[model samples]
Target: MKIPFSPPYINEAVIQEVNSALESGWITTGPKVKRLEELVCKYTLAPNTLCVNSATSGLMLALKWYGIGEGDEVIIPAYTYAATALAVIHVGATPVMVDVEKDFNIATHEIEKVITKKTKAIIPVDIAGWPCNYSDIYAIINKKKELFIPKHENQEKLGRVLVISDSAHSIGATYKSEYLGKITDITVFSFHAVKNVTTAEGGAVCINLPEPFKNQDEYNYLRCFSLNGQTKDAFTKSKAGDWRYDIIYPGLKMNMPDILAAIGVAQLPEYFEKTLQNRVEIYEYYHTFFKTKSWAILPPYKSDDKTSSCHLYALRIKDISESERDAIIDKISKEGVAVNVHFQPLPMLSLFKEMGFDIDNYPVAYNNYKSEISLPIYPQLTKNELEYIVSTVTNAVESSL
Candidate 1:
């Protein structure tokens, strides 16, 4: 009766795609990568999409392109994983960590309070595939628009604060009846192993900008940025009499190889309606099962304005300390049912602490962290396995108490 948490849904179709890619001699950034980018554009309805090696790289590129740098400040929720804050730090910007709402999203009021003239961007993380309140975030940015200072051309072109969505867990999510890529200035999605849709080790950056700034230009620039800022990709260079290329920007090597892109193309065709439907059903079942328990504090998966991708079932244990929550997780593990915690807020982590942040300042983030335990909700779980998970989790929780 052993159950693992959040394994990627790999089937024969994914393997076939990988096999086809292996057979193809052009394995690095070729037709398959181009096709995946096109599929991403069609699926998300974003004007342009760029596939990168990982979500961290996508977020970093977005920050760099938006002109976030030394002396500039990027606001982020303290409740998110370290990658959210790390991107800001790696770009040499000061990360102003804000408290999160009870729903594990950055507080709009907190965002406003921390915003100053140095504020260049705000990275709002969809902690568990649930879309944050972008409408309210947009409103806050509009109110504070007067204070934002542009340090570079790209930033000035937008003429306002940039909203870079850390949508690592929320690829297929919807906000205000529109896809996630449409809500933010730039949205980064992860295709890590545990994600709802995986590409082994890959990510995509969806650019959505207004009239003054062109998404096509941004996409072209990002393509270069992902490939060591090369003037031509490997595919183009392979053409006869086209071995010439140039380095345009001081970009890192982060382009997605064709093999990984092949997997993405296979997994993406029926993602929204077919693949994601399984996760939604599993999430709903957990919600229904947990509601009858007094100790269960359910995660917000569905609301009037948004529906999550059901990436993580981050259930909280009401009135419990962090130790108690850990004890419950240990009990479940010993019983062969694997569970996890979505995150420990950035301030509590060693890196942010050394950087002069205090977890006490982010009371809301710590409160949310102390009692949270993420349950399994992948697309591959059978009915019998799910039932066993439910019973084992219930029994383990009671035993721990």
Candidate 2:
């Protein structure tokens, strides 16, 4: 009856694809990587895409691409993983941590309060597979356009604030009937082991910037930039008499290798149907079981205009103290059931604490974090195991209370 947390869904097809890529001579940023990018563009409907090593790399690259640097400010949710805010910090920009709504996405109401002339970008995180309210975010940014200061070339080109989505958990999610990458100005998707769709350790960036910046041109630049700004990659460099290459800029080494990309290519065909559907069923059952209990507060899975990828089942035990929540987790662990917390508010972390961000300032984020418990849900989970989990969780919470 042992239950583990999230695990990668690796099938024989995925294995064979990776094995075939290994058998193939080219591996780094080759045909397979290109295919994954193409598939992502088709799936997300993003005009341009660049496959990178990780979502953190993608986010940092986007911040750098937009010329967000020292003295600039980027807003992000306090409730997300450290990578979201760390990306802003890596770009030398000040990250303005904001609160999140109960759905675990950035609080749109809190965004306006932090808006300033120095605000150059806002990285809205779509946590737990739920897409952020992009329509609301866009409206807020559009309303405050006049107040936004364009400090760099990329900034001046758009003459407005950039919207970069931290979409690591929400690749297949939809907002207003549109996929995540298309909803924001730019979106970053992670393919880490625990994600719904994994490429071992990879991610991609989707560019949906304003006019005057053709997506292909941006994509080409990003491709070169990611490979240490080399004009030609090893693939092209291998061709006869094409040995020489030039560095366009001092850039990052974050390109995805073809071996990893092969897994993604194998995953794309059945991602929305089989894998995501499995997590969705897990979410539904959790809701069905927890709804009978008055202590249960379920995460939002769907709405008239949106649908989740159903990545994490972030359940909240209402009217409980943080200590009680911890106790419940301990009780569950004793029964061989594994669980986790989505995140502690950024301010609660040491780095942010030193930066002088107090968790008390974000009351809503703190409230959500204190009671939140993430349940295990993956495609391989069986019906009997799922039933055991629900019952175990129910007993754990009630007994702890």
Candidate 3:
């Protein structure tokens, strides 16, 4: 029984929604996209949300909206998807890579060391669906606001160095009793096919800022920025008598289409409990099996104040070289049971190396990357298929020794 990594769980609802969009003729970023954005905002309990083409775009827009650019720096976990750091660079800001904690999420304690005069923001990623220590991050940000970059004399008084979260893997995760989207200044969610909740190819940014930035009416302005930084979106300009609009800024085209949002809106109703429950069951199955293995170090599950979204199940084999990890993956694939690695630390990748980052400097991230392996935990896996996966992993591990 060949068990693949993560086959998207699509049903008739998704297909019908797409068919409806195709039939509507207004399949671009139109009414359906607006409805999806509303659903996302309601689900995340966020004051505002903007749907975009991808999570990378969501992160880039967040950084741009916060005015982080040249002469500024943003701290990020070295262990996250490259998209996290790449978004920082996309906005012309320096990405200060920091080591993660033993659990493999961003180390909240280390954020203070990297804080400097140029530090404009801190982007703590919720790697593998486990929420970062947002309370600690919030405490640190409030206590150390003096270390952040000073506000421009002309610009409005900025809030504390913006706490943007790369919550790509944590749509349903909670930190300190609040959902991920509400726990930070800004949070980005990826609805990629393999994610916990999928929209085929889509993402959303949830804004939880205080005061003047909290205007509910600004959602249209955000949609405009996503379209092309224009004063009016294509939807408004397409009206019978309103075709004129002005460019507000040099923005990029990354808006989510109603075609994609159709899937999103259909999938959202099943997100909170049903989909999450299936993922959790898979997670628990893996945990029950691997916890007894002496060489297998499991990822974090429980925390003092957080609950995971049960995203990626990253397992580390103790005392193994990076080559050994690769060999294990090869062995597993050979058994017709597909598996994958979560990420290679950004600094180890050539793009980052060219940008003057050294992998050796981030010892913890390198260590985590070398020892880690991600198992398939999607909802579609049957009980028998899961058993095969577990047996295959067990055989591969014992054989590797």
lDDT for each candidate structure:
0.90, 0.91, 0.85
* Candidate 1 lDDT tens digits, 1-401: 78988777878888999899999888999899889889988988988999999899999999999878999999999998788888888999999999999999999889989889999999999989999999999999999889978879988889899999999999899999988887899999998878877789999999999988889998999999889989999999999999999997998899999999888888988687698898899999999999999989999988898999888999898898999888888888987888989799998888989999999998989989999989988888999988988888899787776
Worst 10 residues of 3 by lDDT: 150-159
Q: What is the lDDT of residue 297 in candidate 3?
A: 92
Model 1 C-alpha RMSD to native: 1.0
RMSD of each: 1.0, 1.0, 1.6
Model 3 RMSD, rounded to 1 decimal:
1.6
Where in model 3 is the C-alpha error above 4 Å? 151-155
* Ranking of models by lDDT: 2, 1, 3
**If both were scored by TM-score, which would come out higher, candidate 1 or candidate 3?**
1
As for candidate 1, its clashing pairs are none
Q: Write the per-residue lDDT of candidate 3 for residues 1-401, one digit (tens) a residue.
A: 68888888888998999899999878888888888888887887988888999999999988887778898999999898889998999999999988998788888888988788788888998889999888788898888877665655212455578888999999988887888888887899999988887888989988887665643645556677788888877777788999988998788899988898999888887878588888889899999999989999998876778888989899899989999999998989999998888789988889989989898888888888898989998878889998999889889988998
Least well predicted 10-residue stretch by lDDT in candidate 2: 268-277
